[model samples]
Target: MMQAMTAAVAAMAFAISGQTAPGTTTRPVLSKAEAEPFTPETYLRYSGLYSAPVADPWRPKPIATGRPDYLVGGHGFASVQQAVNAAFRDGGAARRWIGVLPGTYTGTVFIPAGTPPLTIFGLGRPAEVRLEFTIDATVTPAVWAEQVNAAGRYAEGDPAWPMFRSCATKTSATAGLCATVVWAQSTDLQLKGLTITNTLLDTVDRGTHQALALRTDADRTQLENMRLISRQDTFLANADDVTRIARVSVRDTYLEGDTDFVFGRAAAVFTGTHFHLVSSRKAGGGVIFAPNTAPNYPYGFLVTHSRITADAAYQTAPTGYLGRAWDQGASATGYLPGSTPNGQLVIRDSLIGAGFNTVTPWASAATTARPFTARIDEGRDLNDVDHNRLWEHANRLTAAPAPAAGTTTSPGTRR
Candidate 1:
């Protein structure tokens, strides 16, 4: 059944890719009233097995000492990495709860795969516990070329060498550091009540700068009541590879970014979340999401019962786009097998602030065409009709009011 479905999806993707020609046959656009209603069940159904499966509550057995398996700061371990190392030494069957005291931590944290069931929770409020780093994607190609040649991470004539050179030639941030601040490659991981941030100031002038705070590539991962702070590529919902679909959920969390921040190809669901748009150098305006949903994956990214706001600095430029279809075949980054450029996003029952232009909130990152016009670039265009897989139902946004000066955010007009 799965193989048949995959074949059908591939056929649909091919059809959509060929539909961008002038005077060609295309799918008819659906009017607002004619569109299907966006609901939680719709998202879950598309998510398929990638959504969190029903499991019994996780209750780790207590040790005789009655203490946490590891503790960070507050006189325990001096660093988060230290605690993680201790957890590794004790093996997977030991105590599973790792407690973090209220404090600001500045460093990178890695949780490797096949570790064990773990729950890392913070004792204080979100503002109290912060794991942060500063690395911007501003290194020039010349500098990158010299540095990589000296380090010998890549050699000429290799299949991946050209891809590396291409990325180096582009203005790239520290892709390694930008993409791996808090990488969780292990399954059954849970992080709650803390803030993970990348304290790098990114602007369009910086050139392809991508500093990410957290990357969740594990299965059945859950994050609750946390704040993800960054300018670009803030929170990436990803998977280990293309064969298996990973599921991640962020509930009652805060995510802020400028461009393609909340992105990736994983089956991710954001419920009761707040999305903030910081001032970006992209004068065309920043995009909130760039979902590269695989053709076979029905659910890409779901933003439901959430609020999206923008700072006053975004008033002059065009309003932000709710999301842009990030088709994979448009660039070298999307050149992997089982990759499809078609994007699937659902925005439903959310209060959208005036920061988004109501008439055309959906856009395409692969092309320069306006919203609702499908124009794939570099002869890889797919389904240019904006409303094809991207749907909006019962979303309410008020008319734009005059911008106010200060740090205050204007409330959205909720009907």
Candidate 2:
């Protein structure tokens, strides 16, 4: 099955590479009222698995009982960046642990590529230790640098200062890349029991602005018991390059956002997590996941044993979508399938709440606005790369029941 799917994807890529004209065939777009209601069993029977076995969960070893290598908050260090700088200066391939006490540290943290194996964890609950900022994608790099270095947090002698300068000198085309509150580029990085938030949720209108809470661009990154909050593009599981593999394992975490909250191109697995979709920007509802997986790379995202819920406002109306493909760098008219990045995602053994659209859960492509076309609907083999690469298997949904005060209620049964 896997070999056939790979051959099909490769064949599709080869076919589109030589094609000059758009395909003539068109699939019928079903309306919300006329579309058939979504059934888990029926959907799985048609849309076969587009997933593979993920790597085992990776986690950083717990800090020893003695004083940590570096400490943030209290009398240790003024900011998390300071501790990270100290770690870089005391450079070695050995693991370095930085324990953060209970306090909110507001700043943009940039962990450079050459840092040693590092783990920055909170001493208390995730809510007690916060690393937050409010910077949107529209901000220019120069303006972002000023805001980030306003308090003189990053001094000239600091090892992170040069890294910050490198990021600040990015072009306007990559303005959105600098809006991350915490960006880590070191391999074997781990974050635990902390809250990272981008407070740009209500500052700007609901548009294409992306404010990332945490962006990891390294391999073997693990996040445990963390809270990531934002609006669009909350937590990015990124890679240094498309060819290089970056695997992130997020376990027992709480992620909250409105649109495309969890997105990126890395091979990420989210297990035992809670994905909360807020209704603050309810104009067009919201999307939960957007994976921009490379054409050749099979693994994109896998969400297993997780709960995906939405605000109470969407319980009755059901306006949210499960996810959509982020066709990054695809042209408006010449969106050649198989050649371009086709996102692949699988949500198995999970509980999808009542707020998502029952009939058409997946939305159109994020960048090219390509209509959501599934290979199964076209009578082709499953995992055909010519269409949207989204699939689900053995998933369940919550029953439809009126929500109670400050809580969403479900019928005593699972669908």
Candidate 2: segments with Cα more than 4 A from true spot: 1-67, 155-157, 377-382, 405-415
Model 2 TM-score (2 dp): 0.81
Lowest summed lDDT across 10 adjacent residues in model 2 is found at 14-23
lDDT of 2 by residue, 1-415 (tens): 2243234223323211111111122222222222222222222221112233233434434333335789998889988898988898889999899999999999889888889988899898788889999888888888888887888877776777776877688876556767899989898898888899998887788778889999998887888878899989999998766666677778778888888889988878787677888777655569999998877566678877677877767866788888988888786655576777788787765667667876678888888888887643434433457777676654556644543568643311111
Q: lDDT of each prediction vs. the true structure?
A: 0.61, 0.73
What lDDT, from 0 to 1, does candidate 2 have?
0.73
Q: Report the number of the highest-TM-score candidate.
A: 2
- Candidate 1, position 407, lDDT: 40
Pick the lDDT winner: 2
The residue-by-residue lDDT of candidate 1 on 1-415, one tens digit each, is: 2243234223323111111112212222223443353344444333224333333323222111225678888889976766765675566554387788899987666676655667787877877888876655455556545543444534564323544465466655444433435767777678877889877755336346777888887776777778888877888887666555666677767788878888877767777777878764555577788886766555667777676667666655556777876665456463332344456676665656655655466665543232344332333233333333565545545444553475454221110
